[model samples]
Target: MRKYGIADTTFSRVDMGKIAYKIIRDEDDEAEIIRYTVPGIKDLPVAAKRLIDEGCDGVITLGWVGKTMLDKYSYLATSIGLIIVQILTSKHVIDVTIHEDEADSEEKLKEIAIDRTSKHARNLVKLVKEGKNALTKYAGKGLRQGFRDAGEID
Candidate 1:
């Protein structure tokens, strides 16, 4: 059996818990979901900490960082906070976010958010339920911003 938690921010339109729920339930595995909603990106770490303290084997934090300069700085702070939370709690905090600039329109943003959230949820299962063996499936290999998914240059 595995237990998981979802930390979502109230400011965003994306619903990470709902996405995670669909994916987790499809696996037909026994698991408990603890949903924690936070005010914004900055609160993600604290909410994740709460889930860890609650005995959740893993946590998935879903949030969005707008393209504004202030939001970007806030995202950096949130990322650092999550790092600290992981070090202190000794638990997995899967942070999934879609930067506002990643998509040019609202619909595009929603599409990206849905894709990122669902995929990361699967990763959560791979880690907490299957252990370290999940690393066998690596990502970002031979991929670059401009090169996209192309293999080695040479």
Candidate 2:
């Protein structure tokens, strides 16, 4: 059986890791799912890297960024760290983040987190089961996870 990793942050208002774990478990019963929770978004990179080193086929990292400028910079740095981890391990680390400003209300934020985490979790299954090219057909199709697809440009 294949193994997948989920790295999530406690700073997130929503329980994205639980949402993702449920989706992955429900979608693919045969695969093993390992979860690692950190205190904040900046710590996700190392957590994901550790999971990958522990033999996960791929990793899903979930984080929540505030609306502050400092949060933006921190998110950027965290993104770069995740990229470096992927490059070093040659593994797929899917970053799923939600900015607090994206939603107008707390309920909406939860909805976005659930939608994004669920979609990315399924994508992780597809990627591991089929291969990297599994999602290529949707490429340039303007597909989105948390919101409605933008659709293809005419």
Candidate 3:
């Protein structure tokens, strides 16, 4: 696998950053992971695009948008931006998103973020070396409750 980039928002600073590195080390130890924390979710595309141009094979981004009307707009904009980045760069920008409404409390947000980010990070190596079916090996490993990825827990 080639060097990978982690482009996360500072909103989920603690959990996002921690789990990104953890999974890279524990699951894909040979990877060279570089992280860039942007101020908000909207900047994910910029960071990801820059990373791709700088020679990263792939990018994984993590962020949470609060349950608000404004946040909904921000989330949509961010999603559209990332989609464009992926299309233009021809690289996968794995977006690990957690909405405030998805969890009842901060603890749950952290739980979901760690679970999601780790899964995406683990997939980065395979995504570069093995293509899109990176984590398909673990498919059907767990139940898909809400928007959380399955196989995160049993």
Ranking by lDDT: 2, 1, 3
Model 2 per-residue lDDT tens digits across residues 10-125 = 99999999998999889889989999999999999999999998999999999999999999999999999999999999988999999999989999998899999999999988
Candidates in order: C-alpha RMSD to true structure: 2.9, 0.9, 3.4
Question: Whose TM-score is higher: candidate 1's or candidate 3's?
Answer: 1
> Which digits, one per residue and each the tens of the lDDT, describe model 3 over residues 16-130?
7667777776766677888888988999899999989889888888877989999989999999999999999999898888888877877777777777777677677677878
Report model 3's TM-score to 2 decimal places. 0.84
Candidate 1 local lDDT, 28-103, one digit each (tens): 3788888998889999999999999999888888888888999999999999999999999888898888788886
Model 3: residues with Cα > 4 Å off, grouped in runs: 135-154
Backbone clashes in model 2, listed as residue pairs: none
- Superposition-based RMSD of candidate 2 using all C-alpha atoms, in angstroms: 0.9
Which rank order by TM-score, best down to worst? 2, 1, 3
State which candidate has the highest lDDT.
2
Candidate lDDT scores, in order, read 0.82, 0.94, 0.80
